[model samples]
Target: MNRLQKLTALDTRFFYWCNDLHRDLGLAPVSRFVSRLGDGVLYLLVGLGFALWEREQGVIFLQVGLMAFALELPLYLILKNTIRRDRPCDRLSGFRAVIKPSDKFSFPSGHAAAAFLFATIMSAFYPPLAPFVFILAGLIGLSRVLLGVHYPSDIAAGALLGVCSAVVALHLWELI
Candidate 1:
């Protein structure tokens, strides 16, 4: 087998292990909750709430929210379509996923990307909260892999993409 085939085989085996763990824990509801919390809608609402409660902190929250959305959109809509990586559940025979995924490529998980992007952006604004935010992002990323929707590599790439996007956004913000 070629390199790509070998990777796929490995991913398939990993997915089975993930699937077994997911079934053992019966963590469907919790995973769904985490995934939803990592979504843009919650971020927007949280940003708005922060803005209302603490004016200065709210501004930072809003900026981070905007940066996250801006970064996520291109990756979700444009780059994913261009790259077209298949989800583990879709490609692997024994793959099992409790929660259904949307019609998006799985190379770089949107949830992972969004979670990390928000984590990094929030960390820049509130250093103390950085560890918590990063932990949350890491859980969300792991959930993607554990739920059989993504490979370990996919989550890693998504995290890298998120960090890069946040850095670029912060730099541009500084310039402006």
Candidate 2:
């Protein structure tokens, strides 16, 4: 088979492996929690809380995180629509998603993008939190695949976009 075809096949297998492993390990509750965190509520509150305590730092955090999301969201949508990839649970036979998705397309997972975007921004403001935040973000991305809503490649793409969006947002904030 062609290289792209081979890659797709591998990605499918990886999805099944992650999904089954999560189910088998009985980590459904944890997976669900991480999935919800990617919804952006937790990050928003954290940023707002920081703002309440420290005006300057908080404003920077909020601005950077929001800007990153604003950038990530549209780019994610364009990629999703352009790719038109079907979610694993939707396309693969007998596969079921642990959580309901917000939308149909699933090339670059929105959850992964949001989680990574916040993680990147937070890391920028507080370098010491880099390891913790990134680990949490990584878990959120893995949760997407484990929940059977996204492929490994989808998570990768989302993470790449998120990091890039954060850099762009920071640069733009500096210019402004």
> Which is the leading candidate under TM-score?
2
| Model 2 lDDT per residue over 1-176, tens place | 99999999999988888887898899889998888888888988998998898899988889788888899889999999999999998999987898888889898988888888888899889999999999999999998898888999999999999989999999999999
Give lDDT tens digits, candidate 1, residues 85-173. Answer: 88877887765666788875687788888888888888888799999999999989888877778887788888888888888888877
lDDT against the true structure, per candidate, is: 0.79, 0.90
**How big is the positional error of residue 99 in model 1, measured in Å on the Cα after superposition?**
1.3
Kindly state the number of residue pairs that clash in model 1: 0
What TM-score does prediction 1 earn? 0.88
Candidate 1, poorest ten consecutive residues by summed lDDT: 71-80
Give all candidate RMSDs, comma-separated: 2.0, 0.9
- Estimate candidate 2's alpha-carbon lDDT, on a 0 to 1 scale: 0.90
